[model samples]
Target: MRKVNEENERIKRRYLKYLKAAKRKDPSTVQKAADGILKFETSTNYASFKKFHIEQVIKFRDRLNEEISKTTGKPLSKSTIATILAANKGFIFWLADQAGYKQRVRHTDADYFNMDAKGQRVASAVRESPYPSLEMARHAFNYMPEVSEIDQRNKALFAFFMLTGARDGAVASLRLKHINLIDGCVYQDAREVKTKNSKTITTFFLPVDDEYLTCFIEWVTNLRTEKLFGPDDPLFPPAEINVIDGAFKVVGLKREIYKNANAIRQAIKEAFTRADLPAFTPHAFRKTLVKWADTHYPTRQAFKAFSQNIGHSSVITSVSAYCPISIEEQGELIKKKKKRNEDD
Candidate 1:
């Protein structure tokens, strides 16, 4: 049995390169597309693309419906299924135009990659996720124990995320000089920071002043004065793991930065779980910020700047993606309309 498809692999590499260079897609997005294609190929027993049939897509979709999520050990969510389906659909759509595949595969067959209408609705429906309120998140930070230097760094990471609404990747790549305490802004220089789409933007400190923001500033100050860390050093430096008594142990801290967002996410998950709160991924903090802005901002321009603070190019992009009318909020609006009708 074949473990790999050479022809498919060659085309996949080209497709991924196209996605990255031409489409300007992030690594995560490209990775998902690659994973989806790999999964489909494996499911088809590494069948040659030249021998493809529409029936294979139908079979794959049915199999996907019955698949369980690796993380939760339950059936995958509609959103997850939808994303995978879309990836598969896109690959086939693109594949249909390829040299050998043009005759074997039909472009219209890719339509079979879509979920049913009801399934599509379920996949697209917005659901309320638990995000810690500003006050609660502040309390969580205050409550965080910082006996160790590594602990201080971890706490500061959470505080920085809340204060700046920075994406985790950018946070991991931030340097001390990127921050200007006097100006109260972070300069996400694309040359140094892992900004989305390699965008360079300046994000001002949010109005969330208190112990949380104070703690972050103090940590940076301590790094500069006490630890003598330079302007180029990481804001929340990586943990220094040492071998203690022939066993690995987390000791103090290092000047190194995380290679990626995984450590940041793990720390956030652990922090929330320890706080007895539902897990809110780092990205969820952006939603929390948007929700906070919606109730606080008086004018559209103010709200638009709030969105720009998080690195969005436009206000509509922010509102459409992050600040949807939540289910509970929709209910409240409906109740108000009912009362107005009764008054009339």
Candidate 2:
């Protein structure tokens, strides 16, 4: 089998660059789109896309349903298939307008990459799960030991997530100057913070447990006052490792910020594990806050403010994404209503 089509590779690279620089999609998203294109390339034996026929593409789409997923050892889930197909759909649509490919690739040909109407509806359906409760977050934060500097930092990290509902990527990139204990908020500057859509948001301390809030404040204060960290210093700096007595030990904090969210995600998971709770990602805290606010916000204005505080420009984004009532909860609600009617 021919390993590479130089022409296809060049075009794929161009599409990926366009996705990143022009469309502002992140590298991870663009990579997945690349993967989908690669899958198509592999199946077609690196056939030149300029010679793409509707019949070949339609057969390829049918074969997609037959392909087994390595992760699950089954056919790809509806959603996964939709995502893979959609990537090709997007690419082909773009190819139709590109200089060399315009003569062959048609807008109508790209339309074949789409899943059937019913399949798309099924793929887009959202599944609900139990998000961590505020009480559980408080317990986990309190349960974390403060014996070591690393412990203290990890504790503060959890508390900050609970208070601000900031994404893990943004948390990893936070600077000492971004947080204000007196104002009880943090400034998530997208230019620095790796926020979704590069949004700059000011998130206030959510009215949760006081001790958890204190944990967040004390850690920030310790860095500023005792460690003498400048405004440029990392809020939760990367762990400093040193060889002590011929053994590697996590001695203290480094001045460097994490290049990614992996460390923060691992720390929070370990924190939850220690507390004997389900491992929730740092992003889960945002959902916890959103679920809580859904009940408290009586007016549309209040909801909008809450949404904007969490960096969402639209209120429905919060409501649709976070306010999912589970099937079990729905049944319980119905049962309670029935009981109330009988009592009355």
lDDT of each: 0.86, 0.88
Which segments of candidate 2 are over 4 A away from where they belong? 244-246, 332-344
- 39-152 per-residue lDDT for model 2 (tens digits): 988878889999888887788888898999888899988898898898999999999999988999999888888899998888999977556897887778778898999989
* Distance from true location, Cα of 181 in model 2, Å: 2.0
lDDT of 1: 0.86
With a 3 Å backbone cut-off (N, CA, C), the pairs that clash in candidate 1 are none
Lowest summed lDDT window (length 10), candidate 1: 135-144
Error of 1 at 281 (Å): 2.3
TM-score of model 2 (CA atoms):
0.92
- Top TM-score hit: 2
Residue 271 C-alpha lDDT in model 1: 80
Runs in model 1 with CA error above 4 Å? 340-344
Candidate RMSDs in Å, in order, are 2.3, 2.3
TM-score per model over all chains: 0.91, 0.92
